[model samples]
Target chain A: MIAKLRQVMLVLAVAGLAVAAYLTYVHYAGVHPACTAGQSCIKVQTSQWSRLAGVPVALIGLLGYAAIMGSLFAPEGEESRLATLGLTLVGFGFSAYLTFRELFSIHAICEWCVSSAVIMTLLLACALARYLLAGGPAPESHSSRYSTGSSGRMSA
Target chain B: MASRTQQKAQARAQRVAEERAQAQRARRQSRLRILAGVVALAATVVAVAVAISAGSASSAPKTTSVAAKHVSATVNRLLGGIPESGNTLGSPHAKVTLTEFGDLKCPICRAFALGPEATLISKDVRAGKVKIVYRSLCTATCGGPQPGAFSTQQAAAMAAGLQGRAWYYIELFYHLQGDENTSYVNPGFLDGLARLVGGLHYGKWLHDRSSPQLAAAVSSDQRSAHALGFSGTPSVLVQGPRGARTIPYLGNYQTYESAIKAVEG
Candidate 1:
């Protein structure tokens, strides 16, 4: 189940990465995305919120999705799972915030942005479930850290 | 076995069990600590994200609402006595129509507005030989890169056109134009132009600027400019006896007139 979950997350991260990478490329290329709400896509993508500290948010998103993919592929263990959890939670949270901006503040939607956000949200859920089902940490490592040497060797 | 030895063995076994239990408790506490730390980190990330967006939301300074205190007397004399209606600034029956595709922030457009445009308005425009139509080209300096305050300024001017004071607003904007790449184009600038131009209803212009109609109008003008294949601001398309065609530089009064006449001929 954990392997299946990781595969699901890996697939999702790639989808999100492709979307984000496309957005970032277009942003620099000065090509407007095909929009739904008239010029809303143009308006939102070109808005000030699109960049932070001179870095395109799309680039940030690209890196984020890539990080999630990396963490998912890392050798499964307590550290790896914890890192994935941290990164995806941040991704999910930031995605939610950006979606709010797109709908309310920007008053327009970018299909790419929305798709990435959805991917992030789903990835977060999958990650959380996988982490819980995997049950805390790798027992070998956890037990070693708290080993008192005199306890029953068969902890069960 | 001796009774003392049996008691000692039992005591040792009990001690080991207690040690294991204590270790279990410590592990649980450590897990909770890590969980708490992760939660705290997530909270910090969220707070930072919101702050960055909020800061951008208010990146522009508090809008100044100063009305224009210095209306150009010369601008008035030049535009005065001209037939103005809608976005057109000349006699309705003129044989030639000179369409200006411009960004208010474009220096070239400003030059044309302060130079050739003024001449055309005073000369052929007043004489009923030519009419000028002010169309926005946000595709250029104004809309280029990003649709910042310059785009909004264009929209505001278009909205003012709805009230038939577009010409007034256009001329005043050129006269008061600032650095093309700065925050000079803001609500205060709009307010100032409305006041300087004197006949436009400030409230209506403000309301109309962000309206759907203005968005459509601005987009239409820009799209038309794009369709025409003109790449920059202050581009002219002359329509006359020769039909409508984009023309080259209207360098001076003579060049400007010839560009129009050449199209008319």
Candidate 2:
């Protein structure tokens, strides 16, 4: 089960990275996707809220995906599993906040953002399951516990 | 020999334990890889969706330029017998007057010209339902000759007005505007425009443009605009028949449909 869970996390991390990369590309290129039906794209893109702080929102998304991918390579143990779970949770929370902003505040939905939000939600669930289902940690190595039995036999 | 056998058994057990741990690690790694792949796939799908939607959304609106029609013969006939010197576009009996203080070169004024001003002209001015006056405020920066620049442009416009084509000339200038403050008011450009409007007595008009009376009239209009608190072109004032109420310049009516409806009512 732990193995399966790891695979799910790995997949989500890579997927997130790809989404972030594309969004970053669009942000810097200033080439909006052709919008015919709704003229709101330019309005929304040009709005002050399109950038958070100084960085483009799309670039932020790319960095987030990269962080998630990096978390996946940590050594397998109770600590690593917990760390992964925490990171996924954070990703999910941030994605939700951005989604809310898009829906209510910005009033324009970036489809790529929505998809990332969905994937992040799934990733969070998978990470939590791994943490709960996997027994806490691998048994500790038995190096210091006992000397050779051959030395003890002569005394007996 | 018994000891050796026992040692061999322990060694085998240790090897099995190592194999189990290795298998577990490998399994975990594989699972993580699979999860990563799934996420990457989903992200790709999202990116594609965004690209597709954006592509369709921006390709719809098309703006075209149409040659403006000449004023109706009826309008020309209405202006023909009226005295050319004073405000005469609307009813003399009208108590409340609405005047449009505008610059021929201002873009916002140009938009107003294309928008509610057009509606107001058709419904109120042409129908004599409301008295309307146009006060041309050709200030230096707005549309007048800059201090250092050759101002043949304003001269040409004033000349056109002398030929009784002021409104036509203004509209043409707005329609064919170049970059602002770029010295676009050259003689050749003015000549071309005058020719387009037909029969502009350029020499006579140019001579009339700088007349002291015309300059005074322009100044008076500018003062009136300032008194009314209009610092911009395309400012309009609508007053009731009794001159009891006045509405100052508001912005585009696109988002204020209700206000427009009430005003029209």
Q: How well is candidate 2 docked (DockQ)?
A: 0.04
**For model 1, how does the per-residue alpha-carbon lDDT over B180-262 read when each residue is reduced to its tens digit?**
33455667767767766656787888788888767677778888888888766677988998877675332455666767877
lDDT (0-100) at residue B158 of candidate 2? 53
Clashing pairs in 1: none
Candidate topping DockQ: 1
Model 1 CAPRI quality: incorrect
**For residues B39-117, could you state the per-residue lDDT of candidate 2 as single tens digits?**
5654564454344433432232111223322432323433433322133345665444567776655444554554555
* Model 2 CA deviation exceeding 4 Å by range: A1-156, B1-88, B91-96, B138-158, B198-200, B244-265
How displaced is residue A17 in candidate 2, in Å? 25
The 10-residue segment with the lowest total lDDT in model 1 chain A: A145-154
Segments in model 1 whose C-alpha atoms lie over 4 Å from true places: A36-38, A136-156, B1-25, B61-187, B190-265
- Expressed as tens digits, the lDDT of each residue in A2-77 for candidate 2 is 8888998899888888877876765554434344524234324433344554366667667766776676787787
